[model samples]
Target: MIKVVSKIMINSSAKQVWNVISEIQRDPYFWKGMSRVRTTSKNGNALTRQVTLANSEKCLQKVILFPIEGIHIRWTRGMITGTKDIMITQIGTQTLLEVEMNYELHGIAQVRSRSISEELRDEAELAVHLVKEEIEKTQAFPTESRKQWADMIHE
Candidate 1:
């Protein structure tokens, strides 16, 4: 199994960050190398999407863990046994977003996965960077009223 962790600190409230990322359907617009994600099926909190990569390859990605309303989102790709966990935390006036990704590559996929591991890591960093840049540029929550941290997380 291969694991990668990426983090970024955004100059926005956690609530604001969660509001933007909770909508997994919009990931293609922000995440590098991801061209599109189309929902294929949904059952309660579980979701499956047909994901098209920037390279024109496509695969099925399943939502093993959905966004907990205002907390985090997690998904897995069966093709590569890949899993990703996106978590957000509030730190004073800023928000910390972290993504933990793990993938088990078998047979030929192992070579491909290893060869592109750096690129994969870079993509993760780039995604969060884009999020931070966009959020800071828009100041989407400039006027967000201060709420108890717990309240925001559970809201």
Candidate 2:
């Protein structure tokens, strides 16, 4: 098992951040590597979505959303099983977001390969960092996004 954790401070309210994070399928602009995310089911806090990556790879991700707390998502690709957790907390005028991912490499080849865990951890960390940067760009520019996020939370 490989673990990677990343945290970022966003100049936004926790409610605003939570709203954006909860609605995983609606905003492709905030996610850098995802080309598209379409919801297949919406059963309360649990949602199943088909996500297409930048490399045109498509996968199904099972996401469990927690309003104002965090989201947990898991998916399997080939021999790699990935689990990602994203959390947001209010800190006065800003929001603190943390993303953690755990990956497990299966199969005999992975067991024989050295540094597989490190490689996976590095990839997960980089992915979370890129997402944090993408999300912060919205805060920096406040455009229509701030209002949209605020509306979602209040409603």
Candidate 3:
């Protein structure tokens, strides 16, 4: 099995970070190469989804949500057989987001594992970078409490 791990530290609370990423349906937005995603079925915290990649290859995945902790995704069908685990941790005032992908390439992909590893790593990094940007961007604007506090201090 080929494994890839990517991590990013976001300047936001773990709750804020989880609020953005916990929505698994938004994968196509953060995951650049993913063309589309649709949940096929839901059983409480576990759901099945049909994901289509930019290359038009489709895969069936089972995703399990773990609230503010992390996510577990297993690709059940397609040329790739794998499981991706996303872990969230808080250190100081920042949130540490980590993605661990363990997958095996079938058919012709086995021979190209070396190159595929780099590609997966790149994708994973970009995805977390985008999420960090999103969370930071939102935090850039002051909320009601901050704004009110600033106004009172000025007054």
Candidate 4:
């Protein structure tokens, strides 16, 4: 088994960040290599989306959503691909996003000289970077009234 973890700090609130990540079905452009994303099931945050890569390669992925925390997804085009866990936490006034992925290579080594573990780590890092960039581009949420009110001190 191989494990890859990446983290990024974004100048945004956790709720604001969650809004973008939670809308996986609505925004296909946020994905790195995906050209198109079709939702198989969309019942709130938990969804099944079919992603088509630029090279026309397609894969079905299971997307699970978490409040202001993060999103989790699993995909397997072939062999034992892996699952990605994206966790979001509030650090000071910014949001910290962390991603972790685990995968295992299958079949014989002679046939496939390339290391799937290394590839998985690189891909996971790239994916997290893309997600951070996408979240940074969002200007939708400026501030939440709930958060603002909670931050105030009554005299």
Candidate 5:
């Protein structure tokens, strides 16, 4: 399996970062090359979405969210079969966001594994950067977001 990791430090609380990342619906905005995300199903904390890549290829992804800690999105179909994890770490008032994507290429993609791996790395970096920008741009911590995390933590 090829692993691509990206990390970033944002000037915000982990809860603030968690709110933006855990929304799931806003994924395409942060995940570069991803054209769209359509929720297909939801069961408990796990959500299944149809993801459309920039190349117009479609894939199914199962997203499992873990409160303020992390989110695990596993590509269940198409040319990718792997998991992408988004982890949040709290450091004082700053939040450290890290994303790791582990996947094995299939068919023709396996032949171009090196290039695809490089693209994944770049995508991961951009994902975190966009997330950082979104949270920092708003600055204000939405009470609904805070309460949402609070409710999940208590559950």
Candidate 6:
């Protein structure tokens, strides 16, 4: 198993940060190298999406475990399996958002020349920065977003 973790502080509230990161539909905008995301299926908290990478490779990812009020989501498909955890702490009006991705390479894909762990680490860090920028740029946290935050809080 391989793990890569990245942490960042965003100038927003925990509820504000949660609203952005929890919505998978807007993922491509925040994560570089991700071209698109198409929702394939949804069952309760589980959502399956087809993700297109920048290299044009497509992968099906099943978000199997996601609690409405929780900070983590577990997903897996093919040789990749992982959990993305978003830890939020409010400092006045700002939020300290820590996103951690823990993934493992399986099967033949595990036999790679370059370090897959290193690549994942870089990607994870980039994801954190991108998320921060997206939130700051949009200045999100509208009524609907606040509703989602409220739902998550209630859960």
- Clashes per candidate, residues 3 or more apart or on different chains: 0, 0, 0, 0, 0, 0
Cα lDDT tens digits for candidate 6, 65-99: 34323355555664556777767777797877776
Count of clashing pairs, candidate 1: 0
* lDDT by residue (tens digit), candidate 5, 1-155: 89998999999999999999988887888887789999999999998999998878898999999999999989999888899999999999898999988998787789988999999898888889999999999996556524577688888
State TM-scores per candidate: 0.76, 0.64, 0.87, 0.68, 0.86, 0.70
The lDDT of each candidate is: 0.75, 0.71, 0.90, 0.72, 0.90, 0.71
Which regions of candidate 2 fall more than 4 Å away from where they truly are?
26-28, 76-79, 105-155
Q: Output the worst ten-in-a-row residue range by lDDT, candidate 4.
A: 104-113
Number of the top TM-score candidate: 3
TM-score of candidate 3 against the unseen true structure: 0.87
**Candidate 1 similarity to native, TM-score:** 0.76
Question: How close to the true structure is residue 66 of candidate 2, measured as C-alpha lDDT?
Answer: 83
Candidate 3 per-residue lDDT over residues 67-125, each given as its tens digit: 99999999999868889999999999999999999998887777888987888888999
For candidate 6, the lDDT comes to 0.71
Per residue, candidate 4 scores C-alpha lDDT tens digits across 19-136 of 8777676444554556788888878768887887654767778888889988888876534456878899999889988888765545552245256566556666776677777777
Residue range 1-155, candidate 2, lDDT tens digits: 67777777877788877766766765456555567988888898897888886657676788898888988988755354688888888899988888787867566536744575565455555655555565667665535624677688988
Candidate 3: which pairs clash?
A: none
Candidate 1: tens digits of C-alpha lDDT, residues 60-87: 7777444432323333543456677888
Clashing pairs in model 2? Answer: none
